[model samples]
Target: VLAFTATGFVVAAFGQALGIDTLVVRNAGAIILCLVGIVLLIPRLQDGLSRIATPAAAWASRQQSALDDRAGLWGQALIGALLGIVWAPCVGPTLGAAVALAAEGKDLGEVALVMAAFGLGISTVLLVIAFAARGALARWRGRMMAAGGRGKIVLGGLLLIVGIFILTGVDRQLEAFLLDHLPDRVTEWSTAF
Candidate 1:
């Protein structure tokens, strides 16, 4: 996730340096399109199609075993990285904003810090969930299982909504709204940069 986010920042910075208008919004749209494509193309993901359709038992077992292992901090970091990569599709908006900022061609230090902040924000939520996951899973295994059964339906609905938003150009509307409402000072600053 860090790597991906950093890559996005760099791309954005490069775009800004080139004086690209709407760099953020265009790139964000592209990223979302990429995610949609990946989800459609990946056989495993397409087959599962829903949280309920996922092999929760097997996944939970694996997570439990991995957590129980006496690994060092590096192992945890690696696991976290892997998890972030796997979860990237779900984190599109946050990353897209960070990258758009990076494209504004900020100083290297600033860019690094911004990317780090973005990573930290994402990691915070994930870490909290990971910490409580085991207990939550154990206590609500039955309910979770039932939820899983309806996972595909939920996922399909979400995908439908996302598709409609994208196809109907809602992103452009959002971009226009933001740009129209930005403080004059910020717009001036962006142009000056």
Candidate 2:
């Protein structure tokens, strides 16, 4: 996850250096995220994807096998970097704004720190879910199986809502509101990180 976020930061910096419009890239990312959520939410979309899934899966498997045989830890790192590109949409809008700030000649260290924090936050949640929630996940998996993909629907709804919020600029408003309401010290502490 650190690798993923770092890759994103590097890519954004490179893009900015190249005179690319980071805002446009960010908007495109939001659209991609929305499309992913929509695909998950719509059954027909899933059905359409399923048609291509087999061939895609076969090719992916073959690639994975080759990577495993040839690359070891480096292969995993490469995969993480690739995932960073594939999941750029998953980076919250704050990072997008941060990238913009960097492009505007604000401190690059601040942007890197934000990306690191974002990566850590995601990693922590995944760790907690993987370790602390193992038993709960097992039970939830059973229930999900019985529920005929209610789980997917619920997750999809959440992703869709978040995507819409980010795309519509509601997230920036929320962030501003929070900053306005929160203690200065609290905000400072986050920056200190």
Candidate 3:
């Protein structure tokens, strides 16, 4: 995850410096490519993916639950990194600005800190969701499993839409809009470094 974040930050910074209007598009495209790579390696990910990518039709299949086991943090972290890379297109905008700033190629330590902070920000939200919404997610997972092939199709379609949104540069537009309308304090802080 750190390596992926660092590479993304560098790409964002380089794209900004070079006046690349298609940075988001290219990044999204890269994300799609990464997902393709993962899909191609499904044999390797089968065990981990099976738990997360539950078939919708089997929503009520009474599968064994392991949400609270907490026995595989390192393994989970590795899988999470792989998942992050595969889903980058859907959430690229989540760190677009921070990445752009890190890409400025300022101090190496500063860049590392900024990337770390970004990772923490992401992790904080996910942890909160995991803790606070476990029941809801489990229910949703059941529903997804019940939906089965249809559920999978819907997910695939959603991914396609996300891909299209990224390819169309919606994220960049949103980023620009936010930057343009940022509050004075945010603007000042963002410009400080």
Q: Which candidate gets the maximum lDDT versus the true structure?
A: 2
Can you write out model 3's per-residue Cα lDDT over 50-148, one digit (the tens) per residue? 666677526533321232244357655655676656554444544455455555556655555655666667778988988998788777887767776
Q: After superposing candidate 3 on the true structure, give the runs of residues whose Cα lies further than 4 Å from its correct spot.
A: 1-73, 87-90, 136-193
Residue pairs that clash (backbone atoms under 3 angstroms), model 2: none
lDDT of each: 0.63, 0.76, 0.59
Clashing pairs for model 1 are: 12-103, 13-102, 13-103, 52-148
Give the local distance difference test score of model 2: 0.76
Which regions of candidate 1 are displaced past 4 Å?
Answer: 1-5, 14-76, 82-90, 174-193
TM-score rank order: 2, 1, 3
Q: Against the true structure, whose TM-score is highest? A: 2
Residue 59 alpha-carbon offset, candidate 2, angstroms: 1.0
State residue 103's C-alpha deviation in candidate 2, in Å: 3.4
* Sequence-dependent TM-score of model 1: 0.55
